[model samples]
Target: MPDDSAPRPSEEAVEEAILTVASLPGAAKTVTPEDVARSVAAGPDWQSLLPSVRRGALRLAQAGRLVLYRKGKPVDPSDLRGVYRLGLPPEG
Candidate 1:
């Protein structure tokens, strides 16, 4: 469990961090949910933010702003399960 001092970013903030990290110039790989959580967390307690990060990523994927993958394949946003990575949709 995270101590009261653990970071608790807002939903929007978590989503933004996901996008920011995924869109970094030259980024050539998908980002794990833990990456997003770490980006917004202030310390080791970042693990505590995993739930919020996952929730934000799911919402973003459902909205078509992000893609969620499992086993190297994109999973239905409505039926995600197990470990996943976040990436942006291909640009035209």
Candidate 2:
């Protein structure tokens, strides 16, 4: 269980959570930003982690560790908006 009173996760932690959740859906399967955010969220305020989760996902996508999608098609991480999902690279 996470410490409800603890501060929001750091960039590194968010990154790790993104990868961890992405990996769980198996290769080429997707995980939503909310998935990553919930994994590291301190409590019921997981929604507050959205910005950090997006940033972490973008960083991972840039590093070729993950892919970003919108409407079932791949999109540039920097250009992502609204709802999106993350997945491991095809060969992952």
Candidate 3:
């Protein structure tokens, strides 16, 4: 049985959403924060998942598994604001 009482996002859920969406269509594709929020959210109140998504993104960025971008440029996860996108790091 699942704990339906707790509707909040979990770190594992958020991380999975980020990685899953980011890798869905190769490294060139990017997903918005809202995209991840929607993926982990259990209900229509996905807006509430933004904070958790951002936090997960920061952690993934630090671990080098993801990259956060704003205005087409990579931005420090700590400095992200306004609109942002997530994607796998560029291949070398």
lDDT of 2 at 27: 38
Model 2: per-residue Cα lDDT over 1-92, one tens digit each: 54567776789999998988888745347878887888887577888889999988899899988899999989998798898998888882
- Candidate achieving the largest TM-score: 1
Query: Candidate 2: where is the Cα deviation over 4 Å?
Result: 1-5, 25-28
lDDT of 1 by residue, 12-79 (tens): 99999999999998876798988888889876788888999889988999899999999999988888
The parts of candidate 1 lying over 4 Å away from their true place are: 1-3
Weakest 10 consecutive residues of candidate 2 by summed lDDT: 22-31
Candidate 3: tens digits of C-alpha lDDT, residues 1-92:
34557657678888998999888865456889888887777666778778888889999999989999999989987798888999899899
Residue 83 C-alpha lDDT in model 2? 89
TM-scores for the candidates: 0.90, 0.84, 0.82
Clashing pairs in 1: none
**Evaluation by TM-score, superior candidate among 2 and 3:** 2
| Pairwise lDDT winner, candidates 1 and 2 | 1
Say which prediction, candidate 1 or candidate 3, comes out ahead on lDDT: 1
Q: Model 3 clash pairs? A: none
Report the C-alpha displacement of residue 43, candidate 1, in angstroms.
Answer: 1.3
